[model samples]
Target: MIPQKLEVLEQTEHKLVLVIEGISLEMINALRRIMLTEVPVMAIDEVIILKNDSPLYDEIISHRLGLIPLKTDLDVYKLPQECECGGFGCPLCQVSLTCEVSNATNAPLMIYSRDLKSNDPKINPVDPNIPIVKIDKNDKVIIEAYAILGLAKEHAKWQAVSNVAYRHYPLVEFDESSLKNPELNSLIVKMCPEKLFTMSNNNTLKLKDDYWRYCTLCMSCKNNSEGKITVSPKEDVYIFSIESDGVLEFKALLGQLFKIFNEKIDEFITNLEDLEIES
Candidate 1:
């Protein structure tokens, strides 16, 4: 069995960075790929326009609505194909959101995502500021849309995360005595783009203890120090980062990631046993 270690370097509502150790490069890359395209999220797929007094065409308005990211509840909803309703419209597979806006004031009124009302109180747009259209005085706009769980591999609207990537774990090695030139040390300290270096009390170059969290392994320090320093990536370790649009919380996203990973692994093993290949 392969040993693995996971550590969180940084986490926020919409961003996460992790230190993944003891995993092969191929496995880590596969995880990144799955996170980008396989994770499921809720997005508007169908739109009905009953009346449109806005300047934009019906197609443009529908397209904009389709791109709006919606908060997803995996426990409450299932992918349409996987639902018991067999891809037919049902509460377990889809949610309806409707917007009805009329401008009675003299000035043009803007319609935002907040105007849309969802049948399910739990599911709503990730951001309320996303503009759908604008209506002039005495004009009205009405729309009905359906949100469903889907995969990014089929459409980008269903993508749960963005900026999903991993980089090699970085290691910087050097001896203070070897970096004798004060000017070189100062240059090295200042040259680091991530500010992972500093000057020590002894007036020599000092590296940050948690440099791996921010280092891009650019080799700038090694080059600036001439032959005094060396920079390299550690084997079987990676720094993984993910950015989200508030579709899924960090805990849920990671949970779904490993779930898909294990499912694929189990499927592969079962299929392997059925193969009749002879060596």
Candidate 2:
């Protein structure tokens, strides 16, 4: 058993920063290989439609695994419990959809997604019980609509209530008297990597409240400023709820493993005593 715990922290996207304690370089490499190859580990997140037709899979498997869409009420129905972020239910931060299908001769349906959601009559088989379609008598087609899981914490799915995101570091504001040349706004604009800061028609430097989501908190904006720029996140923010698919929560799994290991160790020690002579 390893001496110290492996701290897994959420990084960006589907990647994680694993800080191993008291492990040698050789052991780290060996552990990494074992985890990747042996463990059925995945970074939990919302389902992303990378491609309607992921070429990586066969048509049948793709239909079953990736084709069918997942819809849930987490986006629509508000939770009775008060959210950590104090905001009433807002549609911009939450939404829901239903995916229903039935009666298909073929396995993978090459249907257009935009067309499915945009029909004027709101499409047929909208009811929860009705099948989107019906195929054969014995093999009834089924519609599977539920909240998607199994994506990285960094994936957009990890948002508080929905897949919405905001800047980790907001703009910092300072007073106008602090700069050598208060008239020039070019320096402030140049400091932003996402080009979020711009000069208003009134000649005062302006930041877009809507575009703040792109800010990555690199500190360039703060470094270039001489004075008088008030950097802060937009006051109103939305929250989303997300759940994991038994992945990315490796710590819990590690705990289970340790419990089993101790049990086995006790059994081994007991067996060894049987071979010893009575003292």
Candidate 3:
């Protein structure tokens, strides 16, 4: 039951770094893959362009709209396929966004995400300033789009997170006594691309105090040090980092990941139980 533990190494508005222990490489990778594909986020899937006066075509405008990230409320919406409306347009599974812009000024006007108003106040573009298109004076555009909760498996625009990755925690081994030449020590310290190593006041190589937090395990130091340094991955430990595009909060993303993970496990167990096997 106590198979894994996790600690946050760094946290920011758009990025998170974590140290995970007691988990196998396979398990950690599974989590990453799920976050990249299975978690659902709201994205524009259907568009109705009633009028267009801009230089961009209707299809191009639709594509641009699909890529805009929208704020998601996991509790308030359901995936279309899983909705009680049987994937039909319904309040529970879809939100409508409309954009109607007319350039009255003499100068060219740029259409922004803020120009599109959503029927539901809870779901709108994450960034108000994302440019959709530019229209000349007297140009008018009218559009209606539908946003629905979907998985990245269907389209990348629905992906919940970006830069989802995990790497093994690095372990560096070396002895100062093995290398007598100061020149070699200097080379070893300079070879690390992450700058994880530094020369101490006594002319010995020293790893940074929080090297584990930044080490990429590139093995640059080990390769150039002529066997004086050893760099390898520590077993059963990993560093995981994920970046968000602000569509969904990190908390919501992780919550959705576990919910989907558990459902898969339960399904696998039930299928195995119902299967007949020859002894």
Q: Give the lowest summed-lDDT range of ten residues in model 3.
A: 1-10
Error of 1 at 117 (Å): 0.7
lDDT of each: 0.91, 0.38, 0.91
Q: What lDDT tens digits, residue by residue, belong to model 2 across residues 123-186?
A: 1221223222223322322222222322223333322222212122244565533443534567
Off by over 4 Å in 1: 1-3, 200-202
Q: Which pairs in model 1 have colliding backbones?
A: none
- The alpha-carbon RMSD values of the candidates against the true structure, listed in the order shown, are 1.7, 16.7, 1.4
Instruction: Kindly indicate the candidate among 1 and 2 with the higher TM-score.
Output: 1
lDDT of 3 by residue, 208-258 (tens): 888977888888888888978899999999889999989999998888889
Ten consecutive residues with minimal summed lDDT in candidate 2?
A: 118-127
lDDT of candidate 3 at residue 173, scale 0 to 100: 86
Give the residue spans of candidate 3 off by over 4 A: 1-4
| Per-prediction TM-score | 0.94, 0.29, 0.96
